[model samples]
Target: MTFAFPVVPRYSEIDQQGVVFFGHYLTWCDEAFTAFQASVGYPYPEMIADGVDIQIVHASLDYGSSVHWGDLVELVVENEKVGTTSLTSRVSVRRRSRSDEGWSDAVTVQLVHVCVDASAFTKVPVPPRLVEGLAAARA
Candidate 1:
């Protein structure tokens, strides 16, 4: 399943060259990941409270184009893979002119997170609820 998260870059996020700074895309990816989980009833804080948490093991971004400060960025997030102790999420950064009718892919971000015991920070199997939620949320 795919989840949609929208963001408009803050003026501060733009670089001196007038395009969005490369670093901000990662922030958006993280936000989208959290939002996606919350949408699935697995909010981060609540998960930690339950002694289950997810920790990022890797993140990668492939840039295809530049996005200006005002462009509309729609982050298309979905679970790419799920394993016994880890999961991967892919986020497509779709950017468009503020008044345009269509979007173009600006960046592709992939994040891999491992499930862990909150207290011990040791790897653990992905929770069944998360597995079921991701299965249902797949598009």
Candidate 2:
């Protein structure tokens, strides 16, 4: 199961060639992840307030097709691997047609986020609530 976020491509997200700039894909992936967390009642602000923080330890993306401004993209996210102190999320962005037939894959990305103590910035166990939330979302 995957968490999906709707993204409207902005003119600024495009390059001179009119397709989405490669770098923008990473930003959108992060945005989708954040949005998913928020949807599950664990937004970043709440995490930080609770003395937990997550930092991206790794990220990679593979582009399959070009996306241009005005295209509605759906960023789909799922847990790839969940470890004690780190979790890997797989994200995919696809072109969403206006009629809601669903999405067509355009790109895919994997990101690793390390859980840490906010004050010490030291690695910490993945919060129980977070783990449960992700599991439920996937289910």
- Please give, for residues 29-76, the per-residue lDDT of candidate 2 as tens digits: 888999988876678898898899999999988888888787788888
Taking all chains together, the TM-score of candidate 2 against the true structure is 0.90
Worst 10 residues of 1 by lDDT: 130-139
Q: What is the per-residue lDDT of model 1 for residues 1-139, given as tens digits with 9 covering 90 to 100?
A: 5588999899999999999999999999999999999888788888888889999999999999999988988999989899999999999999999798999999999999999999999999999888888888874
Clashes of 2: 0
Candidate 2, which ten residues in sequence have the lowest lDDT sum? 96-105
Off by over 4 Å in 2: 97-102
- Using lDDT as the measure, which candidate wins? 1
Local distance difference test values of all predictions, in order: 0.91, 0.87
lDDT of 2 at 24: 90
Question: What is residue 131's positional error in candidate 2, in angstroms?
Answer: 0.8
TM-score of each: 0.95, 0.90
